[model samples]
Target chain A: MRSNTFKTLLLGAVFLGAGAVAASAGTLDDVKAKGFVQCGVNGAGLAGFGAPDDAGNWKGLDVDACRAVAAAVFGDPSKVKYTGLSAKERFTALQSKEIDMLARNSTNTMSRDTQLGITFTGVNYYDGQGFMVKKALGVSSAKDLNGASVCVQSGTTTELNLADYFKSNGMTFNAVVFEKQEEADAAYDAGRCDAYTTDASGLYSIRLKMTNPDDSIVLPEIISKEPLGPAVRQGDDQWESIVRWSHYAMLIAEEFGVTQANVDEMKSSENPEVQRLLGVGEGVDFGTPIGLTKDWAYNIIKGVGNYGESFERNVGEGSPLKIARGLNALWTKGGLQYAPPIR
Target chain B: MTLRDKTADETPRSWVRAVLYDATIRGWVFQGLVLLALILFAVWVVHNTAANLRAANIPFGFDFLNMRAGFDISQKPIDYTLDSSHAQAFKVGLLNTIIVSVLGIILATIIGFVVGISRLSRNWLLARAATVYIETLRNVPLLLQLLFWYKAVLSVLPGPRQGYVLPFSANLSNRGLTMPRPIPGEGFEIVMWSVPVAVALAWAIARWAKNRQAATGQSFPVFRASLGIVVGLPVVLFVVLGAPLSFEIPELKGFNFAGGMVVHPELIAMLLGISLYTATFIAETVRAGILAVSTGQSEAAFSLGLRPRQTMRLIVVPQAMRVIIPPLTSQYLNLTKNSSLALAIGYPDLVAVFAGSTLNITGHAIEVIAITMAVYLALSLITAALMNWFNARVALVER
Candidate 1:
């Protein structure tokens, strides 16, 4: 398929293009020298995750993840430049150091983490593969989808999960696989498939973009775990730690009930953890290990807001997707999103 | 002769320069140097790549092909499952590529010949229509055409629930065209064997008829008789065997048709796009081949009181074929290579399934890409070899 093969050749071209290789080590230094942190994003445009807006500004949950890293690095969320990449190009681009960070709504699987010459940071969004179908189809549960035709994107865990799920459940379904999510979406919209499947969060956003969002319903059953997150190149401990904790900073900010508007006010609080996270007066300097300033977390909070705020604005109740913060809520709220102590 | 003698006599003084002045020796030395450089470059590239991969810690190996592919290919020419090894998955992909390429080549050649001849038609409408078809198809990108056929035309057809009924109770839908599977019964083998017997009988009859015409200066209706024998033998045997055949027509079960042969829309679009696009180029080649055949040959036949149709069939086409076969081989190779674009429309061809999906799941880019490139190379070489054999058959034998 040109969708993926074209990307392989494109990556090979970039790989073979003389002198295009970036410095393998010291990405932080390189990013600093260039004065902008380059982040590769989803080129197929997963809206509410990594698609650009009408003004050509990248605005999505995944986009904010990169901005959060940039704020941690440069104390300015606007200092990041974005490169839209396909599923095929994302890993190769990261390995070649073509981008400092990758926030492409990718799943963090064991094979991807260990073998692809890159390491995923903390998960920005906890997701699972789910199905969406037209409301008139009368299909309510995944168990009832015995002989359904499901449109899914190829070359991803989604495809594998679809197969495994069907086999284990003793069901048979026709899979209409496309190399790109957009193609699957079109196929589903054209009534070529009985159901369209992707990450549950993606289903929400994709449904929001459909001609009539209210006509379809996201099935309640989750089929496969999809831990969507950002990643950095392997072999760079400093850069890896910095990106890892950037995600935690957003969660910790939410755990403490802080917001972008109230971040400065919360800086003066007496709680030792909050004071330390914000680098308040006489608090511990936790950013030294990652080679960032003490106010790195503070800058992230101030620039992009906390994880909950970003979630609401980009993909949650405040946005058109209106996805519930199920597993993405803070550990205090009994969700799975738990961060390490800043101290 | 005097200058040559003087030069030969003076050669002893410049014998050191004479060795360099020998063109054959100079050419051999230069070729050897070039070969050495190429070998060295290849060695260096291999070494450098191994070292880079080692540095990156991305283990590269072919052992992973034996592992489970763990994915479903939407379309396959052969039976495949998720648990099939990557090697089997690759075989399915290769077969899919072969089927599409073979069909595309056959369809393109047929259409190309007709359109190519129509381009020279005296009728204004036919000539203009052929010109329009060639211009429009060749100018547009094949990828766009494939997408248009897939997404806009085929995929937008009625869904499975509202599928259109075709002859023999087959169904056509956005899913695909499902045809009835023929179920052969008792004595079917005997009827099947009669087909070859009929073909052999037809061949012998044609030979005898040709010899008779040559010896007696007369003609036989060899083509019609051959066609009749081939068709008549199968029917007579099948009837004598009590019509021992039935069809298992596809019927809508739940989500899709069952007990039938289904051809996915992905393959249909690929075949259509590849054949239509390549036909334009083949048509141009056919036209050039026809023009290359001398007009004097046809004129001579016409002067002998041969009809125009007979002149074209007996005299002009045979000569034109000699010119057409060589370039036509290149068009065949192009169609095969272009089939790699199958993944765009979700046709599980070689590149899409093995190189694209399998590589991604395995995370073994070096091995995957190397194998894919080698397969394409082998396929192209094989196509060229077959065409070369065909070309040799048509080549003129001279005194």
Candidate 2:
């Protein structure tokens, strides 16, 4: 009788374990079954990062990241729906499976990776917190911002960095915070703040959209490191790899000097690495390892180009933001972007 | 109202049938089943929530409150710094919420009463003006109104460099209303203590006068005497202590003011939004309440030779208060909840600082939201309890 009871208990435990496994399915399958990728992008209107343009097209570096992932997964960048999320709502949206991945220029902080039920795929944009002030204010350095009222967006790393920078330097300042980036911009334009602070890249974005772009200038002080990147919900290695490699594919294409226009012709390149990345003659199918088609990297390049191309069109010199590819250039250049070999 | 009533003969046909088929017993059984189902549903919810959290690998616990809130609140109500723990931030948020809600309530009540009475004025212009004010303020959404006020404040005022100097050396600018900081000298505490002591003395005098009036059928000038004690003692102490206070004028140092007390524009916009929008509802409530009291009460008071103002004070308002207190409690609760819209304009209320900023920092959405909801719920309950006690006091004795 005792042995029979123990066997029944063991059988019940096995059924429970099987039930748990069936519930937490992979996100890639969900995206494929749904026929599109739901990506969380910036809703707080940080323009060149992730905001919809006047023509209703979502055009930004972060938006391109989502499109690249969708292109890799479904072989079409347009097979993606964007959910614009604010800084405060992004992680909860990701954790609750409201989106496939968050590409809203979120910083990959240690606490967020280990604690927030989400993991950063890779750094898509390297940023640091900086200040923007009116040129009329005559503030040359951030050090002169003592006793200043600085407008900043809430629920961001900028506020903490501002406080730390001020406190450690033995200065006092007032922070006028707003929930949305546009509101902070409006306040700064309206002269409610002496300086506006955000990620340095975002400062360029903010300056471009200000009422008088010529009146304001971004200050030359980077207060804190903010490795802005795309992130996915934790505990799904298959989905994580698919998203992580989508970014690496962009960098590798950039490293090989592969432009979107030349991708079709370069499919026949003699270089083994280029052939491996574009899946032409490398003999090995790179996409199968990450559960995609053989032309996964090729689709991303064709859809959103390499990282440099996307950056130039959205926020770099090709666009109005005019930001230089300082830290975001390929590893062959004197920049930080590096990707492992595809083969 | 007992379970068994007289002249009911059907249940006694059989002891078994009676126990099984009696109305009270059947009611109890069905209610018990409903209670069981509710309990089971609650248990299922808790079990599923835990299971889902475990499956997603999201930690669901209150331990996050002990973590450092590495974010900075724009308006710190207490001594919260960037290095403070999330628990301390929660306290700062709670205190800020209380400060705004209390100030908004007091301001809204004063305006509501004035407008409510104005809407019923004998003069046509006053009543029509009050009506227009109510219609305009109530029709606009509170969020839009907040944005309007905040944007207006930012646009209307000049920057700190070109701020308008108001009376008493206060500076009015887009940043805020900056006034001189009051530095307390060594003996300012003695003068401060005298004010509260005078209030206690006034309370004692009022009690003694009330008893004398009850025994001798004579009323005393309690209001004037208590007002004197409260104000006069403070003034006398100030003179005796040689008024040990100094004012430090704010100077344009770097980019803004230094050595000043600043009232942030975000708080101003939030206070204005809650007060103006809530006052209209309160005005309507007061108007309805005054109309609720029967005209016969006023007629009876006039029949007793009371004048119009005396009749209103003695009969109409007292009767109207019973109707007003309940809805007024609702408006108070609404005001407290509406203050959470402070998040839109970036006032560091409990929701903005704790649930919005700290939640973003710690990524503990569940715990942060739960704590914020509990704080609002507790605030509402406390307000309701106080209003209920007042409601009971003014409730009809019905002797």
Each candidate: chain B TM-score: 0.90, 0.90
Runs with alpha carbons beyond 4 Å of true place in candidate 1? A1-4, A13-24, B1-20, B186-201, B241-244, B396-399
- Specify the poorest-scoring 10-residue window by lDDT in model 2 chain A: A1-10
In model 2, how large is the Cα lDDT of residue B363? 74
> What's the DockQ for every one of the candidates?
0.51, 0.32
Minimal lDDT window, size 10, model 1 chain B: B1-10
Per-residue alpha-carbon lDDT of candidate 1 for residues B66-178, written as tens digits (9 for 90 to 100): 99987887666677888899999999889988989999999999999899989988999999999999999999999999988887655457888788888888888988899
True contacts kept of each: 0.46, 0.53
Q: Which number leads on lDDT? A: 1
Q: Per-prediction TM-score, chain A only?
A: 0.93, 0.91
Tens-place lDDT digits, model 2, residues A247-270: 999999998888899999999899
Interface RMSD values for all candidates: 2.8, 10.9
- lDDT of each residue in B1-399, candidate 2, tens digit only: 444443555455555666776889999999999999999977765666667667777778888888877666667757977788989989988998998999999999999999998998999999999999999999998889988998888788888889999998899987788899899997999888988899999999999998998899787888899999999988888888898999999888877787768788888888888898899998998999899988889888899998998798868888899889999999999999888878777787887778767877777666666677788899999999999999999887777
Error of 2 at B380 (Å): 0.3
Docking class of 2: acceptable
